[model samples]
Target: MHLNHSPNQNIILEHSSIHLAIKREDLIHPFISGNKFRKLKYNIQQAQSDNAFRLLTFGGAFSNHIAAVAYAGKEHGFKTIGVIRGEEIGFKPELNPTLLFAKSCGMQFKFVTREIYRTKTESNFMDSLKTEFGDFFLIPEGGTNDLAVKGCEEILEESDLIYDYMCCAVGTGGTISGLINASKAHQKILGFPALKGDFLQEDIRKFANQDNWELVTDYNFGGYGKIKPELVTFMNSFKDRHKIPLDPIYTGKMMFGIFDLIEKGFFPKDSKILAIHTGGLQGVSGVNDLLKRKNQPLINL
Candidate 1:
């Protein structure tokens, strides 16, 4: 259960007057990195306190949550089950790096269709899972829960109060919600949603207690898990310049947004900004595999 401090590294820009720093939450751990670590920390403890040994969760094919839960459960001596979307992957798990890694970590998989995966939170679906897995601890998809939010609230430290704007990639909204709740009154939290839609405003409002936040919707790059060649180019160039790697799904999009916003003069002069690097680097390999198959430019590892 050892955790490391996430350092805030300053990003030097030659032209832009906006001061930017990124919280290296990605460096928190190998498998349980970034917001995954924060989201799971308290959930695991609650499961242990409840004396629930087996842990069951949900995710897509290249899900960081599934990988983190698999490794964390193995590390904590809990049996893990991943109810994955896309039943086709169940028949050929060896082809997917994320699934193979989870399997190597001793996670059992139950594959279902996208339609079935949507009902994952329903009582009937959960009762069926309980019947099959026998009283396992259930963690919601993307690991967004009250306890998870509590853990994510620990991401910001006292030193973070110096920043005027805090930025983070929004998935299920837990990470930004925690930031919003933990941030100072003067600090504004900006969320870059991975998925398309205004639904996140409602979702984020469910957990976020503060009103000092805005969603930058322009950089989703054609929805979740979808990317353009320009984005791949930017990510590679960003890594080459800053010595920081950005995952395609979450952090990459947020970083791209931040840089673009800077170029557009969105931030006022001398406005201190902090962007959270919520890790999903493990999925880069899987994404590269997809890109290779699609004959598109791949993200450099």
Candidate 2:
């Protein structure tokens, strides 16, 4: 994977006086882009050091992580296995865009029920997998780990210290954890979780060493993978205005929260805010399919 410095693009907002810029990590790569690219960098190196040529991980029906791991594996000459959640999707994989892409990238699938997937980290489940397949490098769901966090820390450059707030969409908390560690002492790292729960605090604390971060729990738009028509409208309008595409699952929700907070005067006057655009745009096609089926507004790509 080519490690490149993502530029921060200033966003002009007439409604708020806050200085805002978006870290264009989404432009890092077409497939292994954004935080996924960061998260996998060290993990792939560790796998090579350990002499493991196969990479195995977990994700849902439309997981950006799954798509990324597949492409990364193909590009890096490693066999990939995706332990997909939901066994039903395995029977008719063609219907799922994410799974189809992974398959095309030579990623073998081991679809399991949600109940079984819950024990993915357990010794018994892992041993069972090793017996079925050979030894492989294991990446946790959403690719969050110590090595992943180390890669993400590099996302913030020295110039980013000018920003008062560093914001990011939290999935497994890897990206935000890195941001918290890399941020200046006075900078507050705000994480907007895609999932609806307070459990992420613990997950983040496991890796984060700083106390400068807080999770804003009010803008999940119901829950992970759940989106309302208003949120869709906001994302589309944002793209039309800014010419930046945000994935529905993560960045879109975070941007919406930021805009709402701006309207509510959450940030101090003249405060500089930097929002990290963690890439998951590949999943937009799948999301658009769902919206079309529901006869709702589609997120503009």
Candidate 3:
């Protein structure tokens, strides 16, 4: 266990015993902690390799990936742009949490409608953005690109594979897809889909160029970022038991699905599974606030 705890109760549980041979030093940047570094590493390199002076990507208001890209791009001294999913309203200087942070950190943002935002890979849009930004590298939404796949593929190489299966919450599916492709061990890539699913497995193969992955969409708790009372209690007990801290959006639902599938006899009793702690612990802080507002109670399973 190698994690620094804050004075507040926000705990990040890490396993030092799961050491690897090909460890990358830049995996632990100040805000680029956890899978963010792995997920963004090759994307940044690709931007530079393509003679791109600017890097443009897409995300929602409070996306960690967007934040990371902004910070990392600025750190690497590349001009960064964020294609925000929703329209910006009012004459507000400070927008949402992510918008404010991205702008403050020197990442320029362009707001777009949901319909236009959907056509992210269309040639017309790409050409227009290229013209606007002046020769920029295009990273997909959530930084889920081939380069990001290659980068996250390195995460599997960095992990010790003593388990029969690998599980992680899938937002873009790039993370699990990359790991599935990079893995040599005969392990199942159990992915908990964070979206309404939206054919993420197809998107995975499109982005990752691989088919060796499974999508567990049963435990999304209705939709992305939505949480139920059972989920909160389950998260608490999981912390009490394995001491595994989880976000309601990603890892929490992942663990919920994993345990439910286990109870349903999805895996053999002897199967040794290693759940990938693809960190989104910061997301849980906001979840706590939500639970408090809704007067959600904490009870055990």
Q: Name the runs in model 2 displaced over 4 angstroms.
A: none
Task: Kindly list the per-residue Cα lDDT of model 2 for residues 1-301, writing each as its tens digit.
Answer: 8866688999998966799999999998888989999999999999989999999999999999999999999998999999999999889989889999999999999999999999999999999999999899999999999999999999999899899998999999999999999988999999999998889999999999999999999999989999999999999999999999999899999999999999998999999999999989999999899899999988887
- TM-scores for candidates 1 onward, in order: 0.99, 0.98, 0.80
Judge candidate 3 against the unseen true structure and give its global Cα lDDT, from 0 to 1: 0.69
What are the clashing pairs of model 2?
none
Q: Write the residue-wise lDDT of candidate 1 on 11-76 in tens digits.
A: 999977889999999998988989999999999999999998899999999999999999999999
Which pairs clash in the backbone of model 1? none
The Cα RMSD of model 3 versus the native structure comes to 6.0
Worst 10 residues of 1 by lDDT: 1-10
Per-residue CA lDDT of model 3 for 1-301, tens digit only, reads: 1223211121222332221111222234666655677777877777777777888888876677777878788788888999877775214526355556668779988888889889878999988988788878777777676777777776654434655677777888778877788765566777888879568867877765455567877888899877888888788887786544666777778878877776676877566666666665544544465566788863322
| Whole-model lDDT values for every prediction | 0.94, 0.94, 0.69
lDDT of 1 at 62: 98
Pairs of residues clashing in candidate 3: none
